[model samples]
Target: MNPPAEPPSRAALQAAASQRLHPLSWLFLLLAQLRAFALPLLVLLFGGGRREDGIADLIGLLAAGLLALTAVWRYFTYHYGFLGQALVIRSGLLQRNLRLVPFDRVQNVTVHQNLLHRLFGVASVRLESAGGLGQAEAQMDVLRLDQARALEALVRQGAQRARAAAAASGEGPEAATPAEPAPVLWLHLPMRELVRLGLISNRGMLVVAALFAALSQAGDAVMKPLGNQLYAGLKEGESWAASLHLGPLAYGLASLLLLLGLLALVRALSVALAIVQFHDFRLLAGERELSVERGLLSRVRAHLPKRRVQAYTLHESLLHRWFGRRSLSVDRAALETGNEAAALRELVPLATPEAMDGMLQRLLPEGSWPPRHWQPLHPRAWRRVAFPGLLATLAASGLLVAWKGLPGLWLLLLLPLVVLRARIWARYSAWSLEGGVISVRQGWLDRHWRFAEVRKLHALELRQSPFDRRHGMASLHLDSLGAHPMAPPLRIPYLPVAEAVRLAAALRAGMPRDAGVSRARTAA
Candidate 1:
């Protein structure tokens, strides 16, 4: 065998003096400081009836002013500074804190920008480290957007150099294959497809956003009426605006309705905004890295190494089905924290399953990709699906009949049929594991066929409750490296024991044999 070469020395970069906070941000901070100082003093003065008291007012103002000044001073002195090898942040007042994050230890880096950030030409950079607790685990806050990109480029260069140096020193054996030249792949969803995806997701995020906006407006309306009524004698009588505000219960309902309409309008606005944000969105494929840059006012940039990807997934929502569009996800095992949850590295409508497969094959190491031919669930799986639903319905019906009387009995008749249909639907949705990938087909209303790379699975579980064992069936749960605190592992019930073992073996084979890698390959 050829002798491994020594790794190269890593490079380092440094940031300039801390930039001043945005003018708006500075104003907001001042106002917040003032409020914090004044609120307590006002409360104390009113509660103690000490306004007429000697020197109290003067003392309070002095204290408040001093506190605000201190805060401003702290802000300026403890700003963020970047070094090529590590991120440096200094914070605190009396007891200061200085943190240095090495580039090699960094699991991931993300750049986030909002409308304000875009307008101000600033960005927030979040750095995730595997070693830390609670808030200390992830470092984040705003930075100048241009400066952020520069820092990221520095980090990337440093990391590459470190890897090369490690290889040169024979400290890293995997240096057989140097990082590939960054591949250039562009991805997008057409307007029609985008619309379809937006609708199908029924994700309700847009709706929820609209609802919140409407509710806030309604609350403002309600409060305005009350305020008008309370100050009526002091000023003029209530006007139309006041009557339409918070006064009576009837007015509240009207306000709610009006708010609802406003919310609907907001939802539409949000959807329109989303379309604009993601419009002409593109993900460029780099040799060893993936770069995601999207949105209008808020531009986001994420850098991911293909080698670090533990898994890949393709998902389709109802709208995705109608428009034949799919969302592609790549999971980086090293950064299996909340930061990685929202499908870290998402690509919208890259291509079809076959096309995605081709992409995966190109991106992944040879022999690690999953087989495409997945076996669907046995036809008998339908019985398992239907029987439980039926039983639950019957039990519910029996209780209703016993407690509420005859009308409940009618529910009993529909229960069995509903369950049976549900079972058939479940059965129709089939899945199989090929190579290092697991494919699942599921749906009753809007069907989806999802594919996940086996290596991405954080854990593989073979479970058989008493009932399952009796039926000679088992369940396989596959957990991905996502950041969701409550993300449930994907479960494929009604699988045979032998089949589950085979799947486990594949996952183990695909996982990298590195101590630095998480122990996700093991089967349980």
Candidate 2:
């Protein structure tokens, strides 16, 4: 009998399966390069005024040609394939770099398809790992949409297998068995909720502010003329109103109406923006992963391994309260350095409090929201919170007395408001440590709740200011991987020094032994 054919070698299998990006990847790559250099090219083309140099035009053409050539070269050189449980990528034309990323290490896989990509039936794929240091570990600029989905599935299966193997070896948590249930549709935002989300967000104001800043920086030639026109128009309007002999009350009523109209416009813009950004939003919870798909013009599908979640935050703004909605977001350990628009940040953009509770229960069965008991801050914490405002008010009153005499003392009326704010904050601000999780609640007008599993804690800090020392108080701050930079910090301030130390010790002890939670003691 002929000898049994030997199993194919790993190298042979990998070489056989290695694949290049879509044939049109070069075009997409060229477009990306041009987009990056668009501003400079526009300046080079237009900054020359009416007198354009042939040399400059020729140089621009050469640069475009070079970019196209580079894109083509890169498309031909880059190759990716699966080698056992790892994804292997070979890239770089000159240096010839090889990178191997184990499936178990991938924290997130994102597939993005903008309007152009959708038209071409292609998408960009990004793999983010914890060790990427705020960068994507692997990125494929353009791939057939079907191929991208296939790759995502391969990674998911490979990661599941890795987890099973690790569990069998007693090195990781228990893996999901075949009996695990199907993925649950946790949340789906319809047009109504999307509208509510838009109404709750202040994105229109942010957009207007950004536009104003950009206009202000458009050089004196542009902004000076624009500002003069605006001023002259305002003067003309004022003269017109004066000619109408409108009383102060009528003028006030007109101003209020104008303000209301402007606010209505802003809200309309926000609603439109929200609809565009989060159209067809869906969140699905699988056995060990959470998947979110959203966007209208730029469709995005992102997968987050449930194990990588570091913390959770709930936001309730005044508008959200008015709409009976709250937003929930989670911080993941994945270090993502790609387009923020495509990031999987907001888990639930708008949900009723009851709906949010259900989500929290499903997401964290072992943990609870609005913990049974919250440890109140030191009773005198309000005094500390209000001291600065009180001092500022008194100083301003003094300054006013020095300048405008008795009229300056009118500012002293702000003191009551400042102290009332502090009292309200003290009443609401509290922390809770229970069931291996730490939760903090703060704010009066715009309430926020931040919580995280103890095992995910990265660092603990105890800070004491001179005033704190005098009052025998301390502040405990918690740090976790992938905490949102813009989110309110997970800090518990104005705790008795002894209680703070005890809580810190408890947190440190609860942290996983292998996590190596760091502790810092500082005086502020």
Candidate 3:
């Protein structure tokens, strides 16, 4: 190489005119249009699900044309540039939008490449900001991979500089520019593990979705005609419906079997989804950063600072438990509230419990784990846990009796199953406090291991509803830096009142006063 060009000066960037995305963006926009109108496209190709051919075609063409027009307009009008420490993006068709996102508030920067972009050698860059407050602070739909990486690097630098400025404002040299980030590959899912992950992940959810789509699409055309034929056959033969009788217990058993069958179907679908999404999953740990790369159909590279993680969960679904493995998700402090995808970053696709321990140790050496005794909640915790389940069982039985007459009394059989589940939960759920960290083992059919450093604790609360109060039971609730919808709190429910108060008090006093990031945010 002759010489590396000097990085452009900040002043130069300030003087640069706003720029539109690469012309190739039109292709990306067209793909977006197709994705947005996928249902309509299905109706066009397969027919029957929607209205008449004429009406469906008219709506489909109008929607596609409108989507295409909007994409073109957005591509042409959108412009982005840097101004001092802020990134600015302006765009609009009839109205106008000029957004200036300060680097200090930037929470994440990600580079994404789907199959189409791969063919075209382009990527999309998203600069996410504080708490996902509004649509990403700024995003570039199409850029050459090299240019996208450069922009991501620049965004990271701007955020670093802003942090330095903030730190120096109060504590001179205390938060001086941190050392250069040193990245190390800590964990990469192997092909064998990927297969195991596929076997255990949530394919059931996809199966349910597929079932709904089939009903919505082909119900009238296929199911109705099929149902008519079945009815005709039944009328011509013995009328089995009139001869059969079912007690509530028989009904309950039938329902249970049906549910189990449905669950199996869902599990099968989840396995397929896991393979496609986690074909080459990898996690890299650094001094102050974390990197994740995964996806088979669409390559995704996610960059995260260690300080940004608020909390993480180690989940063991029933299927996963059978395979002796667990999955992990990390919640970012600045993640947007409703972004299901970005908010839950997969820390590990799948690993045996022992391997999970090793991986966590490699990524978090200071973090504690077993060989220590686990402390279960109070023995009487079973009472509180079982109370709700009993009430529900009774209510359901009563409803069945009212609707189906005396035979419905057999519904009482469900109560035992509910109570058994509660008993299992009380037996397995436990919490332990060690070395400034709190670990909770939760879930009954599925298991979860959640960790939070006590020093990084943000807030603590003790709760005792009337039901809990009647039984001298209380729950200790703790809040850490990160928040997530899927991530449950590091809570110990149905503990003795004294234990709850004592735990809450200890956490409040032990919380870190000097360090900025807490246990969940630690890099290692």
Candidate 4:
């Protein structure tokens, strides 16, 4: 008898249907690359009569030619397909890469459209997977807007099938049937609220914007000479005050006036940025997802799975607190892969304390969602705060004396400010655990009322520093899935040592019994 035919190899058995990106993908890729060079091009345009144009033009043309060639090459070489339980992409012109993204592991599918894409009627699609760290596992760089949406629907169907198959065999994460989220408006921030958000936000961002504007506005003749002078003075070790030939007092006064002018400019720019970025801010909560859409000239539409929201941070700056307003953000797990678009979203531009609490209740429904009463930390917390302020005051005094000589004695008047700060910290910094939530209210100058559902807590710890131990105090720290480097740490510092340990234990008790309990093995 003929030997049984050898079983088909995996690749042969699971055939992939190959496809190319949208034909307009070349233009999309080319523009995506060219956008980064826009700043450099603008800088060259303002060469201010200090530089010749011929060399710059030649270099720009060559760079543009190379970028276009690469885009063309990439479009021709790349291919993607649905292949046996995975979406596989074979890409790269010189060195090929094969990426197989399993349907069961897909975390999210994102669609993006910019002005150029919208103008051309094409969009971008990104497939996010677990552990990808904020970057898409595979992206369909350009497609018709409807096509992108269709691709997203296809992925969701695949994921649902995978989950259903797993459940049939008694293993797999369960999810409800996927459906289009009918838009439900939770909040629509008005222009007035956006303006208030501007006042509370940082004004320093204006300096960066102004610097870019100056590069484009000033000619090479103006910018180059100014740059050379600043560079030469720095290389020569001459202070700016000394270089101007002004006396110490005149230099000091002039510097102060310049700073005041900068502050005014920053305030104006902040207002403009707020108006531009949040002109028609709208938040929508759906059955399975939450979406935020904002921006005036260019738009951004971002969504987060409701179950993937790991934490919430409400920031109330001193100015905001004074005005009885707070801003809210949610940490989305989609950012774990380092996706810039999936970072923490400001859900509320500006709201009163009561309004914020109501929003939180709607977002995280627990027995006692946002516990009102906060337990005060150890009294020593204020002393811990006081020492740092005093140190800062002393440092400021020394710097002033070195800069302007005898006039620096004015720094002594700041001692009262330090005392006031300590009192503020003593009054506001506290935490509590009520019902099934962990609540913390913190900050002296800029305050926030933070809370998380206990069932969501992933990890907890208690620690004591040398100072903390000496003062009979410890700190309690909580870790959730979506930790952001820029967001504030969830820590309650300067709590009684015993209290801190108790809090840790309580959080451990609150965790899911089926998930976190460690099993002890008996000796074999």
Best by lDDT: 2
Put down candidate 3 lDDT per residue, 1-524, tens digits, no spaces.
23434655644553453777888897688887788779768767567655554777786778778888888888887878877787877778579766777787777777888888888899998877656754676778999898899888888888778778767676334385765576778778777787787677765576678877887767667888878998999696545533567667876897799799877776667666777777687787766677788877788877777767766688988888788888888766665532224423677768778877876665443647652668788787877778878888788888988999888889788888877888899999888887667778889888887877776667666777777777777777777765676687778787887887777777777876643322221111
Best-to-worst ranking by TM-score: 2, 4, 3, 1
lDDT of 2 by residue, 323-435 (tens): 89999988877556554323467878889999998888766636566588999999999999999999989998999899889999889889999999999999999999877
Model 2, position 389, has a per-residue lDDT of: 95
lDDT, candidate 2, at 275? 91
lDDT of each: 0.59, 0.85, 0.74, 0.74
lDDT by residue for model 1 (33-53), tens: 777666577655454566555
For every model shown, the clashing-pair count is 32, 0, 8, 14
The lDDT ranking, best first, is: 2, 4, 3, 1
Give each prediction's root-mean-square deviation over alpha carbons. Answer: 8.2, 3.7, 7.8, 7.7
- Which stretch of 10 consecutive residues in model 3 shows the poorest summed lDDT? 515-524
Task: Name the candidate, 2 or 4, with the larger TM-score value.
Answer: 2
The weakest ten consecutive residues by lDDT in model 2 span 334-343
Q: Which of 1 and 3 is the better model by TM-score?
A: 3
Tens-place lDDT per residue, model 4, 273-322, is: 88777778887777666777777755555556777777788888888977
**Best TM-score goes to which candidate?**
2
